[model samples]
Each structure stands twice: as structure tokens, then as C-alpha cells.
Target: MPRTLAERTAAFPEPFSRVRGLRELSNGVVLLTDWIEEKVFAVDFGKGSATPIGRVGSGPREFRLPGRLVPLPGDSTLLNDVGNARLSVIGPDLAIHRSIPAQRPGAAYSMSPRGVDAAGRFYFEIPPWSQGPAAPKGDSVDIVRWNPRGNAIEGVGRVKGSDRPSWQREGKPRLTPGIPMVMFGSADGWAVLPEGRVLIVRSGDYRIDCLAGGASIGAGPPYAYPQLPVTDADKADAVATFLQDSPMSGRGPNGGLGHSPAASKEEVAAMVKTNEFATHHPYFRAGGVCRPRKASSGWSGRFSAARHRCSMCSTERAGWCAKCRCRWGGGWLGSGGALSTR
Candidate 1:
């Protein structure tokens, strides 16, 4: 079982609305992004308090929905302001050094996380729809690399596997959320290694690939999927779990038993039949966990190298960091409890 290091009631300068991403540095400083507040907070574990890195706005140093914080050398880091369609470089003092637009102004292309290679070339992923009329000609697409010192962006490595949606493959129109439609074996996440190789993490299947230039140099350990299909017992158990987790279960809008006080077995069975696979197997893992206040008040998380190969750090859980090598435990900041590393 995982153990706790330190636990306390953390009162930040302000309450966090929604924590999108977090990273712990080698110096014992924690950085977190609040999706709702649209700013990053740097907390000192020794101080037991938090400070906002930058104001929340659409200006140069401001952020919209800051999701991921990638730390660079010399205490500088990159903030992925996904909602703003830009990346901001944060200095050691938590000041915005500069901002890099993810796409051409008014362009519709969606960019992936900004990763830095050993040579310091920043990479961006262009999903198919965002590629527009001049999108790549094949199913496999490449990641773009931008040199910060100069003004040039070039295609470097390819996104290992294809991520075409399941609805498209089944010849059906998509009406539900786009995430569940993403095929299981498709590429989902990628990170640039310390040696400049790109590490790609897939979802459709559990696999990690290390790529150089545009080819695979090697791969990490393989993760086998659950070969068994969804059984009736599994369906019932899933429904039970959902109901037990639902806050509105057994209560109506007026807080009283309404037309249907409880879910019927038949209704649950129908729901299972409709959403068994999607509900059980979420699109992808967020790669971190958050512990409850009773156990650990402050943020405690792990770090991952490529698809959660947690060998570099000492923690029993898995997370990702560019500068830290500490083995921390916890989940994604807003997960409410510890997240599973595997």
C-alpha cells in the first residue's frame, strides 16, 4: 500500500476552484494550475501556503484555462494555457517571460502540450481537424517543433499511432462526447525525453514508444488489455457502482421520492447495455492522483518519464516532471483522493 509523507490543512492565499494540473520540483516547490481561476499557484511545502504565479487574464502574463505546467531548466517553465491557445514561459520568480501563440491568429488548429527536447526545440501537436485544408495527406501526423530563439516552426516526429474516432470507423454518426469516440489503441499523450527522443503514450492499447526525428528508436514495456468482454455480472456491478457514486440517487429535484424513487433493475440493465464499455473504460488516464484531506491536506503526487515508467523517482505512484526526481504520492489535484499509477 502507498504511504503518506506529510499531511496538514493547507490554507492557500485563495481557494482553488479547479486544479487542472500540478508538478513538484526538485527544490520541493509545488506548482499547480487552476482551470477555474485560470492561473498557476506555486506553493512552498515548508510554508504551508500558496501564491498565485500570474494574474488571470488574456494578456501576455495572464492565462485562461491553464492545464499543464512543464518545468524547464533554471527554474523557468512552460504553461499550457489550452483555453487561450497559447504557451507562456514562466521565470523562476513565477513571472511570465514570454508568450508563444499556439496557432496562427484566428486559425482553428488545436495544439498539444508544448514539450522541449534536449536541444530545446518546442513541439506542438496539430490534430486532424485543426490541420485545416492543408492537413497532412495520411492518417499518421507529425508534431511541430518551434525554435524559440528564432521564428521558425518545423515538423519533426510523427504521432506514432492513429487516433481516428470509433464512430467514423463504425460508419456511424457521432452524437455523444468526442472523447469516448476516440479509439482505445490511439496515441493520447507524448513527452520529450531528456535525451531529445519523443516518448508517446497510447490509450487504445497500453504502450509507450520512444521516437527520434520521426522514427521509433525503441519502446517501453507492453501493457496488456483486459481480454475478457463485458459480462452480465460486470454490467450489474458497473450500474451498482454508478448509482452508489451518484449524489442524486434516491432523491428528486425537490429532495423527495418522485415518480421513480430508485432505479429499476431493467432500467439499470438498459443503461449498462448502452454505456457499459464507455463508462467502465474511460478515454485515458490523467496520470496523477489527489489524496483526501483526512489523509494528506496538501498536494502529494508522483512523476512519470514515459507513460508512467516510475523508475526515476522513489514514490510508489506515477506522475510526470521535467525537473524533479522525488517520489511523491497523491492524485491529480482535483481527484479528491489518491490516483492509481497503473
Candidate 2:
């Protein structure tokens, strides 16, 4: 059975030694990490003090904002770049080696990538954000599997087609905890299980979705149909329908409910249908200083201006809604508005 939060904490190697950071290498050595203030530390089974690796990021070259790190074959380390959009390889000393850049930003969610393969090939993943803020409307994402050896990333499958592995019993830790199959964002990205099944998690009605890819597979829903008329009421209905199964409402880390409008309307419909939404609870993953307990307190104000604390504190971000942030399809709203020092 998967250990509960308390159980996992109790089983820590040492008391008072909380798990602050975590990353799994391609070699299967999961880094039990801790970041005290600004410094970083990770441990091995030897109980040696965690090495102070330089920094982490999700950019192409630098660790700009490393979401996760995987130990590549031959002592090489690949850092998933959240900022620069690339896979950065670093040496034992934490020096930059080579980087595999993403074809587009927003495509790969550097936060979670499966890792490199046997023959020096890297099977990375991109979320729905691959399409820049402005692209042809209705354009969704396609999982691009990058092969550094060949300097190419072929489309392995669409966001919804890569899930056979996630569903099989092969990927879960056979002996230990019971973490359900969640390939990145429910079924929104790439996941290759230990069984070698490459399954896609999709968003809408399966029949309407057109699965597309190379030898691999991808899926897309039909854009215009009798059921989806281009009327204001229909649009509202569609958006309301969109909210029902959006990843933003899930209970994953930081509230699990993070929204990505990159998927086109048809894509959105498909994602909901696949039922591959994030499952982590967001309330428990929140990070924020104690809110000044003045001029606010109530469930009603949670969405109102009075309640300023993070609603999804456990998993919620420290910003305003993505729509309110900029013309650029990201949410800048958070504890710190124009100048709150939040």
C-alpha cells in the first residue's frame, strides 16, 4: 500500500529530517533531497551527507529553473528546463554538458519527464503549453520523442495517445507504495511504462478524437459538428463543460487543478473524456508565509478579494489567474499583486 503522509514521514531515515526535494535518476536512484533556504542537498543509500549540487532549472542550457533531474547513462545528468525549454545534461561536478532543446516552448512540462532510453535516446515529455500564446486556434500538442544521438525528436504520439503503459500494472513500484498510474497530467503527455507500453492520456470523446502520429499514435477531436455550434450560449456551455474535468480542479500537489488552455476546444473535450486528470491534492502542496490575519476570513471570500491566502495553498501557485496575468496565456496573479511583497 502507498504510505500515507504521516507514515512516509515517520519512515524517514532520520527524525526531523523531512523530505524537501525529490528527483529520480535514469539509473533508478531516487534522490532524497532537502533544500534549506537557498542551499541544496541530496543523499544516497550510503548515508553520506547530501551533496550540494549547484542549482536546478528547466531551461535548455542552464538549469534555469530545474523541475526535475535524471541521471543519464555514463554519469551524465539531464535537467528538465522549465524556463528555457530544454533538456540540459550536466557532469558529476554539476557542469553543463550538452542540451537537447525543445522544438517549441509550452509543449514539454519540464516539471516531470520520464528520462533517457537504452541507446542514448531521450524520451522527454511536453505539456499542453507547447503552443505559444498565439497560435492558430484549435491547435493542440503532440508528444515529440527527442533522440540526441540523431539530433531529432519524432512525434511519438499526441497528448492523448500515450497511455498503454500508464494503464498496465508494469509501471508501478511492484513491491512498495501504491501510486496510481498518472502519466504526467492524467493523460496529457508521454509515459512509457516498465512494460514498454507507450500509452497516451487524452482529453475528450474518444470516437470524435482523431488519433495521429508516426508509427506512434496521436488523437484529436473534430472541431466543428452539430453538437458544438458557434453560438454564445454554446461557447458558455463548452467552457462550463471544460471546467468540469479540467486538471485545475484535481487534488494533486498545489491543489492539482492547474489550467492549460493550450489544448484546442476539441482537444479539451478529448482530455476530459480520457479521465487522465492530475490526482494530487493541491491544499497540501501550497507554499506561503502566514497571511496577515487582518480584514479577512471566510469560505465565501475564498474566491473574493477578502480572502488573500492561497485557496490551493498545498498545490496552488503564488499568483493571480492565468487569464488575468498577461496577454501571454499565463497567470501572474498571486499573493504578490502590483506591490504586496508577497
Candidate 3:
């Protein structure tokens, strides 16, 4: 089975240039925009292969170099264009709807913008300069929000900005600690949680830091999962099911033993006899092959895990069920698509 995953960038039209900005519009469409090239494009995200749906022209007045693509729940979308400080929206067919407009902020950013919340709100900051001696600097680089319906922009909190957007402010200073390799105006470089919470990922450290004021900051607990023997098809279905189940997880369990739904009937029976999965998850009254033969075309290594992260903590085993008691979980074979796992 494939042990890792990666995102492959698809080639665009000749004049299209590199996709500097990308996001998902509600109708399952993938939006791609280019700042240097000045254009916006859309595609079906669920297709076995990517396909562009539409294209539009958005030049200087619209976006100096649009940085990020944000799709709000409504008919609105936000573009991190230079002049405008907040998001801008485009209609279904391809028309600029409502946007705060990135007016010349007394400063121009060579970099493109990257992210925004589903709420149509986001933030940006100034940076230090290169080719000239300067320290990281900017206005009180802060986070703010915008409401499409109301067409309003409001301040949420401040992110320490520099007097200049030098190598450090860009998280590329020689003295900086770089882990995730986030550059200014990068996507997935900044993210909004499913809960509408904002967390800033330091491009250098890969350490996630919450942006909203009074937010908590800490690394999650070290977790591990078991690996199972299965074909690519079963693994694929399991990934889809798992993702469907956990709406906001970035990475899945670290494939491990018992964690794989590929366990044999006898192995499963023995596991259930010990009440392994049932102990952690109260909902898991039993454990066994909910189905196995049909696992190829319609197969999903199905196992039920007790709700792990909840308000109340129980003695129940959590995660991949390596050693915790009563671990509850589910899985599938590569029945869906092998690429889905990565």
C-alpha cells in the first residue's frame, strides 16, 4: 500500500501562468487564480481528473496580485488582491459581485494573498523589503473580518508585523526557524479551521499558532495508528469514509496494526472477545466484519470507533487503539481510489 501522499499541480493554458491562488467554491468547484497573469478559473474538485470550468479577467483595479482565494457559504468569494484589504466576490457565471477592494494601502505587496474563513473575513499584513537594508516592518499587521451581506470590514486581532516585510517577517530570515516553508502570500500557508477559528501557521516552524485574541496555543498529543494488510482498493474507501467521519482532521492515523480493517474473521473475533473496540467506544457494542467480500467495488474497511474526542474523558481507548482500553474505530480497503489516501 502507498505510505505517503502528495498534491500534483496540473498544467494550465499557455497564457494562464502559474496558479498562485486556489480555493473551493461551494458547488464543489475548484477555483484557480493567477496574480501576475491577472485571471480567475474554476474546476470540478471531485472529478477523477481536474477540469477548469470557467475563466475571467481581473486586472490591476481588481487585484494588484491577488494572493488567496476564499469561498464563502453564500454566492460570495474573497480575493486577497493588493488594493483591497479584504475579500472580493464573483458570481457563479463569472462576474465581480461585492468585495472590499484592495485599494493602494499606502504600500504595495509583491506577494499574493492566501486565505480567508468561510465567513468571508480575513486578515493581511505588511512586510520588510529586500535588495535594500531594512528590518521587518509594517502597519500594526492585524487580523480583521469582512461580511459580504453587510459589505463591512472589522478588526479582529493583531499579528505582530514588522517595520518591513524583510526575510524574517516573511518567516525566511537567516535567524528564523523554518519548518513548513511558508512564503508571504502563500496558500495552505494560512488556514481557517472548520470551527471558523483562525490559526496562523509559521511557514518556517510548521508550528500552528492561533490568531484570534485569547486563543490557546499548544501542540496536540502524539498519536499513532495500526496498519492492516489490505489492497489499494480497500484503503481508498477507508480514506473517504474516515474523512467523511472526521470533517476537520488534517492527517489520518499513522497506519498501524489492528487499526487496519483487514483483520481476519478469527482475528476480529478474538479482538471482540476481549472487547477491545467496545471498551473505548460505548456505541461499539460489538466488533466484527460488518461485511468483507463486497469490499472491492463497494468495500470500506468498516469498523466502528467510539467517539474519541468529546467533552467527557473516559477510560476508553482512543485513536488507532494501539494499547488503550475499549478502542473503537473503522476502516476500509482500497476500494475507492488509491489517490484518496494520500
RMSD of 3: 18.8
Sorted by TM-score (best first), the order is 1, 3, 2
Off by over 4 Å in 2: 1-21, 24-29, 32-40, 45-48, 55-62, 83-86, 91-113, 125-140, 161-189, 193-197, 200-342
Q: Which one is best on lDDT?
A: 1
Model 2 lDDT per residue over 3-87, tens place:
1111111112432122223443333233432311222344443443455555544323334333445545555656554344466
List ranges where model 3 is wrong by over 4 Å: 1-3, 6-15, 44-67, 83-87, 104-114, 126-189, 194-196, 203-205, 221-342
Judge candidate 2 at residue 92 and give its lDDT.
Answer: 55
What value does the lDDT take at residue 334 in candidate 3? Answer: 16
Tens-digit lDDT track of model 1 for 126-186 = 6655666766654556677767677576776765444354555465876642333222233
CA lDDT for candidate 3 = 0.36
Error of 2 at 118 (Å): 1.7
